[model samples]
Target: MSCCSPEGHCSSAETAAVPAPGTTTVYTVTGMTCGHCEKAVGTAVSALDGVTAVQVDVTAGLVTVVSTADPDDARVRDAVEDAGYELAGRATAAAH
Candidate 1:
């Protein structure tokens, strides 16, 4: 197990590296300006059934969700909405 970086953001570095044992889905959310926004999004998504872990990056507007099972897109949309951000939709690529 790892610890959160000094950035104080919700990062999956604490979970494991890439190719972790689960279905990782990355979504793009808009209008998040700070770490609190990231936490809000992470909390909302983490409440979903089968969800195992969540990491939100406000700078990139990406929320990466790791779950034991696949999550419905509508549910994801609602979760992001509940966090006061619009789900721009699933991200095609987190890396540029």
Candidate 2:
């Protein structure tokens, strides 16, 4: 069986290394349906100031960011929007 959909969207599991000196924040995003989407969002978010790493889970609509400090929500939102996706805000227990 293939991990990708007929439309070319892959849901294979991915993992990111933990950053020892950074703060981790996970945000929910919408409209990421493929590897391209993941790369686009990851690139955008990774370019933000203080961002140390980014992990995008397309299947779960989650973007995990590691930064030197707590990142600004608005900046993250703008970056996601600029990448042609919608930021649904930070992931919370209710978002699960």
Candidate 3:
């Protein structure tokens, strides 16, 4: 699915480029229902150090994170929690 914010445009932190040696991870997030929820999750995660991009899929409860380094699981969990959602755990490496 497209990573836009449901406004037919690229979203905040959803288009940043990761530096070298970076990795992308898709974490399962629960309790997101709409664009605002998606923004909350994306903003929180995107604020982290080394985070380069964030794409939230409310329909699938997925948050794809790209960073200049491997993101720590605990930090991502905390970010999601701060966004008022639960991190269901890592889903997989981000696809593209």
**Which candidate should be chosen as best, given TM-score against the real structure?**
2
In Å, residue 84's CA in model 1 sits off its true spot by 0.6
Instruction: Give TM-scores for every candidate, taking all chains together and pairing residue i with residue i.
Output: 0.76, 0.80, 0.74
For each candidate, the alpha-carbon lDDT, in order, equals 0.75, 0.86, 0.78
Quote the positional error of residue 51 for candidate 2 in Å. 0.2
lDDT of 3 by residue, 1-96 (tens): 544456676423242333444587888888887667777888899999989888787777878888988899999999899978999898965522
CA RMSD per model (angstroms): 6.5, 4.3, 6.0
Q: Candidate 1 at 78: error in angstroms? A: 0.4
**Residue lDDT tens for model 1, 37-82:** 7667878988999888887777777778888888788999998898
User: Per-residue lDDT for 1-96 in model 2, tens only?
Assistant: 333567766653554654666898999999887777787899999999999999898889999999999999999999999999999989996654
Worst 10-residue stretch by lDDT in candidate 1?
10-19
Model 1 / residue 1 / CA error / Å: 36
Which regions of candidate 2 fall more than 4 Å away from where they truly are?
A: 1-20, 94-96
Model 1, global lDDT: 0.75
Give the Å shift of residue 63 in candidate 2: 0.2
What local lDDT score does residue 3 receive in model 3, on the 0 to 100 scale?
Answer: 42
